[model samples]
Target chain A: MDQHPTIDTRQTLETPEGTDLSLYPAGFWIRSLAYTLDWLLRIAVVVVAGIVLGASGMGQGLTLVIYFLMEWFYPVIFEVWRGGQTIGKKSLHIKVINDDGTPVTFAGSLIRNLLRVVDFLPGFYVTGIIASLCNRHFKRLGDLAAGTVVVYANSVAASPVLESVGSRPVPDGFNTDEQRFLLAFAQRSSTMSPARQAELAQVLAPAVAPGDPVLAIKQMANHIVGDRTQSAKGHLL
Target chain B: MNLEQLRIAIRPRRDWEAVDLGLRMAQQWWWPMLRVWLIITSPWLVAACVMPPEHQWLVSLCLWWCKPLFERPLLMILSQGVFGVELTTREVLRATPRLFLNQVFLSLTWRRFSFTRSMDLPVIQLEGLHGAERRDRLNVLHRIDSGPASWLTIIGVHVESFLMLACVALLGILIPEEVGAELWTWGFWGESRTGGALLILFAYIAMAVVGPLFVACGFSLYLNRRVKLEGWDIEIAFKRMAQKRGLPTVAILAIAALLQLTPPMLPSAQAQSEREAVKEEILAIKKGPDFHRMETQRVIKSTEKKEEEIDFDKGFWRALIEFLTGAGSLAAAVAGIAELLLWALVLLGIVLLILKYGSWLERFPQLLPHRRRREYRPQTLFGMEVTKESLPDDVSSAALALWQKGEQRPALALLYRASLTSLLTVGVALREGSTELECLRLAERLQQELGIPQTSIRYFSDLTRAWRRLAYGHQAPSDAEGTALCRDWAQYWPEVTRG
Candidate 1:
């Protein structure tokens, strides 16, 4: 088959402990969002702590410690204890992990969070952004130095129902993924613009049927996404 | 493909690809994106509608600040859309009731003003992980291949502001001069009540459109990052291959996945290489190539003893003696021969001067061909790309050979490079670093200044355009298209000697 090869952009990393970590490093946007969310919480803590600590006689000293802990140990504490979710990170669904896809160890978290100072640079994480942009995994200086990776926390369930109500006889030579792609193309076509539907259809037309295959592909799609109308198997014809 | 068929539904891709995907995905789920925006902004919309005109700026500011709140639902829509599923507005709203506390806790912070908030939405809003797990997951998800999402959010916000200003300005243009005079006054954004209201309205529109797009972009980037991390594309390919061959491919995937986790034996080698990659590829390209020019050939003369002065005197004297055949005529002929010999020596001196300093004398227009002569020995030019390493001989002959072999583009490129190389005489000082556009611009500027003929300039310009169109624009030229251009090659470059 003259296959349109599926290009995998995953960065496969090996661990010191010999675990293969396939990770897609989030870019500036995702990391920045998590940082923003975390920063917001940090500010709230500072405000509350300032009031509470200012009331005490040992105010300034206690405040500095709180600031240091929140700034440095906050991410580390959350990542080590909560399996990588901070209050901010949980909201966004991103997590910290070792470069090899293992749980972020305490040492790894400490190194990464500690190196955040370098990532911070003279001003607004400028060096970090540049570092992230330069690398394929979008690692900031901290992540690079620490050998940590940021990845999307996958959902456990994969049972989301597609449109298919009953079995449709897929062609013999076709694989499960192709069949799934064909079904997806078919299901998506109607909901999509006519031109987009055709475009998607046209791409997979040869896989289903090579010559004047548009109608045949559509029929196959119709077969796969069984009729929704109750009682009768509407694919009678 | 047309706008309707922009791109594929799902795949692991880069930042630009994510941005592009967001825009394209919006085409299919534009309804959901718009609906989510409309629903979230309804309070503001109604407030703006019902509030007094004077107080609208406050409403606008509030709406702008609360964009984070509105973005949550749309983020859901976009996240689902990334997986080829569009979430209904009702479904999104319903799921959010239980997650209200999480959303509120996430929203409250000074970081709301921070630009990086755009990318962070996915971790907090979508994932179920908490504490250390969440942090670890964030570590995996946060290092997005697409730089920082803050750029898009910030740029999106700025673009929205610009769009608002332009729209308000356009609206301001419509009013009659008498009523609109104050509208055109400086600081109208804050000054006049009417202008302020217009600004607010446009700002609202900007928010309505850009807010959804902002979420969509973030969501797409987030999804792409995860897809890349999980090796979804590789898994899909393997799964497909397995189904085709009826082999146990899932186990192979496990092994392949396991291999990646195994620690690299040569970590220092990787680190060393990383330490060495100081200058990025883009910077090197921008620095461009160095220029080198060959010196023109100097005319050399040979002095030999065979150049004895008696040669001309003997022939003339013998001829005079044979033809005239008298004492008085012979004496006259000898005197005439001496005078002729003196004139001949002077003529020889003049010819030697012209031959020895021909390049200097050719500077004068009427004395010789007004040519800019140079040796055809350019080793490299045009970003150091047009090298004659493959063709070691004259350019035209090499080009002809290439053309015969059906190498149309290379042949044209070679011809153009040679012309530019020849133009080095007129101080074209083109360096290896000079880009194609730079070369064309230099050639264009020099055309009139160097007094190159218009038709010849057009030929070079056509060749440049054709070469560029083929190389960069990905368009190939028609066959036998430049036959006339080829025949008039001499006219095109009358200055330089033929290569």
Candidate 2:
């Protein structure tokens, strides 16, 4: 009943300029970390600005303006100008892009950051956290309004695969995963206790063979490898 | 194809790989992951700080109970990230109000107490399945725990406890010696509820750091399972490969057509009987009361399911109304009543006919065409020609000739591939994409089982080493070394056909 079932998370988008770009969104914590980093940096900058503009009424007014500009417009200015990254976003290797994986436009940047107030409700960005958590793209209210997504700056490493020796046909009713499990079970069971082996083999017993499942699995393992070596056998090479 | 050129691979991964991928996922998404962890647990953090040590755990217990509240949002965040989608904070929060009822129901289960709950979170919060369908989906998803998710969750909880204790003890150091002594003592926690608050606060911090990882691991395992079950990875891999090759339509199109031309693995009679037997078994199960109940529940919310049952009070009135309205009208207008009744009966008969033959009727068009197997067949493997007849009859001598001619690598590959073929015939279930080490290990284990001579094992081991060296290290074997392997090949596969 999911209005949108997982339909696969690999998103493909045609950029405004008409090239296809694919991206994986950054997770909540990674983006939060970047945001936290940015927050700290901004706080430090504000503190320095406060000290520099020390107690005079004129200076106090100037500091307020500086703080307002920095607080409200920091992310917007940097995101639009610095290739969709603020200082924090850049450090964490995440960037803001349109929903279609295109570079963020100035308008997209402005709207998303502007909606930050709503996302920050009930304090500590809780509303925003909730929004990002429940959202498909981890977008806060701002990003949703602007139709932008935040994606990992770099590509994910390809899944590591066991080295391919060659194409070998698996037996009937068994898939590649079963083949992997069978092989792993067989290899690991060599050093396992008999009781443990029996316990584990019991689960696989019905599917593999009738009796002495462990032995059958082992025999199959031996058979699959075509091991001709015996404790005592002389064969022509 | 070489590793670099292979655009993408879609397949079920080993357990370690799955977990490693979880860690990889965490690294990819550390920020919002960390922030949300802190944000959700912040209340518990406050409770621990303000309340005494004794009362602090109550707060934790509460947090633990309401874990699903915290879990759903986090899962959405991670799942979206997995798919390369991003949402801002409020956007994530925006859906929470709407899903409040679902969260309450999903979070109520005892399953939440264990780490295994992490695996189930996505189904509960995301899939939008209810009642029986959710149960069935759970059955399919949780068939295997993959071991790590549950074990890690327990370990994380235990570690959090210890870390909490350590923080409490550290707090003890800041107090006066007498108070400090009291603080560190076992009864000190029991003496005051407020005393433990500090301890709980620190524990909350530790939990934030550690909790998501276990949850992420569970989530990762869940993701991996779905990937395997649904072939998501394969679909993505194929898409990537097609894109990289810039032959999106042609290559896959050709292969898809090729698949259509292949044959089914089983004979028609045997396959048909097997299919029928399976169908019968399914029918028998489906006919049972349990199956009917689950089926009904699949599409309905658990809450509304009971409403569908007959209401005894209303049932009588409805029956009375039906009986009273029909007969009196019939008496006044017999002809009209008879004509209406006849039409109703005809429509009922037509409805019954369609229901009875619905499945076959839907399938009628598909049955007209001659069918073929649609399994994907590998064309080239191990950068070598692969065919039903590619394996040599005499592996050793063939390799020996190649070695003499200074083509040592292909010679070794020939011997290795031959050994693999021999292994497959004997029932070693190696796949095409397995690495050399995996092959070596499998062969080593099976070599002992087959009881090949001790000298042959040693020699086979040496040849394996040589291949591993040449393939990965790019170091060629010396003349003497090459001749020695040439000597050993005949020993492992004694029945090698003479070239």
Candidate number achieving the greatest TM-score relative to the actual structure:
1
Expressed as tens digits, the lDDT of each residue in B440-493 for candidate 2 is 676667666655556655665777788888989999889888876776776765
Predicted complexes: DockQ each: 0.02, 0.01
The residue ranges of model 2 lying beyond 4 angstroms of the native Cα positions read A1-237, B1-11, B44-57, B98-100, B172-181, B244-499
On DockQ, the leading prediction is: 1
Error of 1 at B418 (Å): 42
lDDT of 1 at B469: 83
Model 2 complex DockQ against the native: 0.01
Error (Å) of candidate 2 at residue B411 is 67
> How many steric overlaps does candidate 2 have?
70
What is the per-residue lDDT of model 1 for residues B400-429, given as tens digits with 9 covering 90 to 100?
667778777777777776677556655554
- The docking category that best describes candidate 1 is incorrect
